[model samples]
Target chain A: MLGVTLSRWTMSYFAAALAALLAGEVLMTAGYGFPSAPLRAPETLVVVHVVAIGWLSLLMCGALFQFVPVLIARPLHSNTLPLPALVLLLAGLGALLAGFLQLAGTLDPAPPLLPVAAMLLAGGFALALYDLARTLWPAQPLPLPARFVAVALFFLATTVTLGMLFSFALTTGLGSRPLLAVAGAGLPLHVVAGLGGWLTLAAIGVSYRLLAMFMLAPELEGTRSRAVFWTGTAGLALTVLGGVAALSLDAALAPALIGGSVLGVVALVLYGADIVHLYRARKRRIIELNSQMAVFAFAALAAAAALAVTLIVLGRLSEQVGALVFLIAFGWLTGLGLAKLYKIVAFLTWLECYGPALGRVATPRVQDLVVEARARTWFLLYYLAVASATVALLMAHVLAFRLAAGAMTLATLAIAAELIRARRLVDVSAEIRLPAGAQRPHLLMSVPHPSP
Target chain B: MTQDYLDLDVRPILRDGGEPFEKIMEAVAALAPDQGLRLYATFKPIPLFQVLGRQGFGYAAREIGGGDWEVLFSRADIPAETAPAATPASATPSAAGASDWPAPVQEMDNRELEPPEPMVRILAAIEEMRPGEVLSALLCREPMFLLPELEKRGHAWRGGFEPDGETYKITVRVGETGDKA
Candidate 1:
């Protein structure tokens, strides 16, 4: 079997991630974040962290738990550790949100909890990183996808470390100049490391493998893929360096940032081209719903990159940065995450339920587990709502943005419902009886069985 | 568990540009359940290994002098009372041992098929195979998703990319009680 075991807690992580996503979306819909509150407001920070750490980080971690083994062609080091890691992360996120509320004076009677949140989050991330690293350690000279994940893990550590420092600074009253500098100037660095390095780079790497596998296209293992990795890594490094330099009040920050942005754009462009090539060369002429919806996410990524660059060039980035971040977070990263989850959930459920029965009795194909016709509308609604929200943000139309956010929340809820249905085997035909000894899996929890 | 051997040589047929497959199958059909076959050919017959393997014949092949090949096809269900004196000079032994597996009963070329379809076809095909029967398939990519499922269903499989470095070939042995052989 080549030792590839299914990750038991991946569904649990996904459930938590989706809940966080819905929470973030609902918060925005209720006018908690910008365009309602100032971008720097603690209320906005609460929403941002809810989405970034709660939704995206959990989603990525869950996926990697399942896929890193596939990428390395090895079994996970430990399956028991993920549930505890998830528990720590959720608790940390809860504390972090509460701390933000305290900072906003909404919970003035509460003690300072940012440091506690930081410690918990750091511990959780550490455990995850250790488990993944142990799995990857033996498989030296990793494949391209695995390399991306390895690099992203480094950035994740850096992001968490920076966040911890910020939390401490804020809690300690930021009296020292260095602490003040880290608290004030390091926010952008944290964002770049977390969103760009940890999240986007990892997403790009994973997508390269997955898209090719699903499409049955030739994997991009040649010079182009190498170019993407090198450029993307170098760009993120330079940008992060610039942010560090800014904290130290260095004169080299501007040039470093500019150079980094240019390289990042080049990497993204190459990646976009590679995706197009995959679609063009795909053997499956009929594109599946997940792959089709991922196109909008890719477009959003390109648009966000272009818009950010244009704003930077015009020296108007600060003024419109809120809208740009909204596009990147909701339209690009979250969009891609949601789109892929639709297929991944179905695929995993099929493996769980039908795998044992395979070749022993009649079984439904993985495609049979998902009704694309029902999901297609929700996906369309999601992208449309995100677009309208982005437009409203650009126009500084607060009420319009809120309405769009409400629509986005609705679409996300509908998609989540579909994912749940897939997990429950609700979409599978009743006529195809499950083979003897093959039982339906739980929706959120994995039932223990003898190891294969 | 000793059985009488029926000797067949296809080298002369190949020298005259005649197809030997039909003659080979005819010999296979004529053999008693307790009998085995000794085959000689001008070159190593890789495809025939699977062809006969499906019929519950374990094989051991060795290269003879002057580019000729000698192969022994034995019934796998029978206990090996004695090891053949000639070591398997050229036969590639799979996980279950080369001489312990029968040829694939069902063969599929799933190169152009998409995800799940290839898996679906393979699983469905194996369900119809008799216990101890083997199936062979060719796929465009390594059947990553299919491998675990095969394990879960208690089937044994060996696969690798062909010499072309693109096409993947897999041989699966149906397990007793739908368990791994």
Candidate 2:
């Protein structure tokens, strides 16, 4: 298999998706769609969906497509799905953004376009889920991490279905007054399903494998890891379903929400402990910048939970809702993604370039592909900006928020530069002179680096 | 199958001069049409297995002791696709396949080992393998990373999950093409 590895296409799509995320952030920083903008405003919705669906989802999907093959030790059921999925997702995303723009009263040419957008987006998710399930179908007793992914996909389907129904309500001015009222009340459920059930659950599953692999620790197959899995699954299920009952049926499911949130927190706390333990038991004593910085992502998750729980306990849900979302998205999920991205890109690039001649030729280690100290500074600045932004949003300080956004934009640009360099194998192959008449195509074109 | 084959031990050359690929290849070029070769090594000879197999030879290995293995090689006058029971599993590793592969000169359970450890250990073991040795290893997953290394070094290998599906067992034979499927 000449330079063929799982999810190469998916990773390429991830690169493109990251660009879209950065663009959305830039637009938000420029005050195009932001905190000061009307709540649920179309432009703001555009930015949010772009980051949520376009960037983060694509990144996660690409990572999964690659890692699953490694986990199962077989090729994916179909390697060609990612390219088509990417196309569908982007097309759907563009349509959804246009629909949002139309809702903002900017483009009202079509009578009801949001439903079509929703259908396209649903189509994309359906394809991704089908491909993912098929890839995992043959495993007799699926691994813990794979099981988590499977459950998360179920939540994603539920979330998308509700989202599509809500889009129809918003666009077509649907029939029943009671249905509209329930849909309006149920909007937050969609948010929870997407962020909590889909994104957070999927991340936990992948992290279990990645942390153990990268840290050189024994696989955490103990009772505690199982605890994290069950608690998380049960918690997300109750929270979403309970929230639905309260919204649609106007029933008193407060206990369910409270109980579910508590379970969710328990899951996170256990997961955090597992992470720390894994780090302690690691055979590789020297930790790299990416894994080291990943600590902050974990901390941010705990902090976000604390704040959310406090808000719920105090009945101050409306006070700083926007800020809480910001911290989770930027400080936790995006932060973790960025940290992992640099490492993954370097690993894949190394495989692509140096893999063929690995035994025959002297090869550079994966760490040699990029300058860590250079990336370290950017990571620091990025986290600082996130922290500052988090504080400002918490305090309702407008000027501070804008300043932090500017800093984040700068830090993001720096990191993007480094990421691109890693992808291109910047300093790896340019200086190496191939022997005359050597026909080794990939190695000569440039190559992979080394790591665990 | 020949009852008696020429015995050639290259462990001494490997320990002294590193890889004895050229010396072994020279001996292969001198073999008769119906002749078979028995080689001894410190560890499974991974690279040599594929190298010799490419020349139309079937091989099996059996481990005699730690850091010691004996592999039997026979020319395939009929272009046999499958490797015959190499030495009748001098000692089989406890697994489902119930294969009669050569006894592993070195046995490693890499289930607890992480990525790159499995790769590194396998590479290091094979480097010390004399002609006709075999190495067996169990891992958490297939060492996809090691496959390219095996190809680069001219080795033959086969691996699959244990009946439990959690444990992946692999075998490497030097100077003989091992089973691919």
Which pairs clash in model 1?
A: B53-B102, B53-B103, B54-B102, B54-B103, B54-B104, B154-B179, B154-B180
The numbered model that scores best in lDDT is 1
- Candidate 1 chain A, run of 10 with poorest lDDT: A443-452
For model 1 the local lDDT of residue B145 reads 68
Give the Å shift of residue B82 in candidate 2: 27
lDDT tens digits, residues A1-452, model 1?
Answer: 37465688999999999999999999999999677999989999999999999999999999999899888778889888888899999999998988988888898735799989998999999999999999999999999999999999999998998898888887856666755776677777788899999999899989988898788888888899899999999999988866676666734456767888899999999998999999999877788999999999999999999998999989998889888999999989999999999999998888778666665566777888889999999999999999999999988999999999999999999999999989888888788735554578789966434233
Proportion of native contacts kept per candidate = 0.52, 0.22
In model 1, state the lDDT of residue A151: 95
Candidate 2's fnat? Answer: 0.22
The per-residue C-alpha lDDT of model 2 at residue A233 equals 89
**What docking grade applies to model 1?**
acceptable
Please state the CAPRI-style docking class of candidate 2: incorrect
